[model samples]
Target: MPPFDQTRFRLPRGARADAVLAGGVFVVVALGAEGQRLSHGEDSAPSQIASWLLIAAVCGTLLFRRRYPVTAGWFTVLGTGAYYLLSDIDGPLVIVPIVALYALAAQGRMQAAIGMAAAMIIGMAAITLAGSSDVTGTAVFMLTGWLVAVVALGSARHSRLAYAEEEARLRATEERLRIARELHDVIGHNISMINVQAGAALFRLKKDPAQAEEALGAIKASSKETLRELRATLGVLRRVDEQAPTAPAPGLARAAELVASAQLAGLPVRIERTGPERSLSAPVDLAAYRIVQESLTNAAKHSGAGQVTIRLAYGDRELALDIEDDGQGSAARPAGSGGGSGITGMTERARALGGELTAGPRPEGGFAVRARLPYGTTGKPMERSDR
Candidate 1:
């Protein structure tokens, strides 16, 4: 035998599913009523037919349960009562109203569902007490328990769905922020370099033709590099079925490239290492590289600095970065103080990986950005005093 696919039996929402549910309820209740009529043989043919019609009417109300939940619930409750009062045959027709009660609660009509359920239970209890109904007290108690359970289940499902939607919305917001930071870092750094080179080329066009030619060449190279990085960043947003990019992401291994670009923009940059080098996690490596790139760009554009120094320190648990420049120090614009997001973006990147970054003008007369990033696993973010 083939394996069964349970999904095939799962009813979809809408009129078709409602019709199927109501039809199934009618068939079940009719069969039970017929069985009772045959076994008792007390109801006349006309009376039995009336009972079947009443059962069908009550079950049919379920077809509109999702569209007008409160209205359908009341209809089924009153119809079931009429079926008991007019028919001689006893059956399981009360289930239709129970299904409608659950639908009402699931649609967030809790007050109406509870009201209908209370009315049904009280009316049934009154008829039984008056010596006109055959339903036992125990049956009424069990029915009350079932109604409560169904309403509770519906409310729980609603809460779960709401939580899932909120979580998905939060994830989407975080992804957009990450993408924005990447674009700012990649495009901003290169464009600033190109602008500086263009200005230099224009200033020396006639007085120093060779120097002007070199500046123009640097501008062309920077522009080409900008396009490549931009394409790589945008590729991440493409659909899964599309071909993915093959280029590696920028990391500390490309620190030399940033140095060369900074030099072309007329800022001298030197890299110094203090400890043995070791491979870093992708996130940490990228964060470190971007911090360096942004710092160098700032030095070239804003800081009247003669030289910039980048120092890397490797330890057993963390990698530390120090980028300082012999610039105008406190006289220069502070990081992120000029409405630029470079410093803010760099700080966000570091903190996201359980790291800490601080950028400030040094008391000794230069600007410095310092950061410490951990390896694979997340650790407590170090405090400023610890740094």
Candidate 2:
């Protein structure tokens, strides 16, 4: 059968014995006929015809060998036994019994294979004794070796399929865990900020009317912003299997909106842009935006500071962004208690984009958060030493 044809039948280890037995029987008859045509020996036609008929019966039984291997193999042994009894010691049909036994061993039922093998040995011995045949000892050893090879090959194929299936399952499990982690990192901080804003709105609603209205407005705005970002990040994860989303993901380009949100939250902020603004890699842009957003958020929560400075500068090999707050500066500021993973998450985001983050109290009594992200836009920022 041709390889790659899905529908083609294969001879299993049990069935292959029958195929060899059938095919060997035919070849024996053909060899006998050729011997007679060459007139090298005096062979009787009736005996030759009987031998051919015996082979046909053995070959015909092979069709049922896969279904009834025991029956087919028994019939094959019986026919070979009878042929050995009738035929004389010669070159033509001498190899048929050994070949049939091999076939039975390769493709017959286990008990049937053993029984056929025993019968083949006994029959060949009987013929050798009665007719003084040559090569009788060689046939017995060849049959035993063929059986072991077929079983080993089939078991190996089974083992390979099992291993491949197990590996695929593990890969799928690891992929799911990775997706869960990314979701937690992307959505966790934003949701917490929303909760904080909403809680403040509810607490101030009764005693301070104007302050309560402002807090409620901030909550609404924060919720809307959180929903929008969640949708975008979810969209990114969903299209990861195919293509990145057609719409560009939000990044440093949205820094103005971030500053406005901080301003609305009653944090006085000054923003300065240096060097010509240009597009950056998506990962770098996203990380820069997150660093600025989170830094501003922390300043509003922990430091009762009125003034914050955000500076963006594009350099030849890197982009530098700094968000410094002149608030009650200290390393122990409680922005969101100890449960905050925001700073850690921001650092990870920057590192993922091949950038660095530095956040600590500045020596001059303020908290300074700086991130330097490499840029490759063919031009450098205007060189000057200005603070």
lDDT of each: 0.84, 0.65
Mind giving the per-residue lDDT tens digits that candidate 1 earns over 23-87? 99998998888898889887877877888788878998888887778888999999899888888
List the candidate 2 regions with Cα displacement exceeding 4 Å: 1-186, 199-208, 232-248, 330-340, 376-387
- For each candidate in turn, the TM-score is 0.84, 0.49
lDDT of 1 at 372: 87
Q: Which 10 consecutive positions of candidate 2 have the poorest summed lDDT?
A: 89-98
State which candidate has the highest lDDT: 1
- Residue-level lDDT tens digits of model 2 in 1-387: 846966576655555765675576667666775675466564588976876677577666766756765665677668766765675434344344344344455442346555655666666566556656453566646644544454344345546666787899988875665454345544544554555556666777787778778867876776776676567667665765644445446687667776766665667788898777766777677677777877776787677677999999877678899989888776547533435455666666667567788778888887888888876443233355444
Model 1, stretches more than 4 Å misplaced?
1-13, 42-50, 131-133, 240-246, 328-340, 377-387
Instruction: Score candidate 1 by TM-score against the native.
Output: 0.84
Per-residue error for 377 in candidate 2, Å, reads 7.0
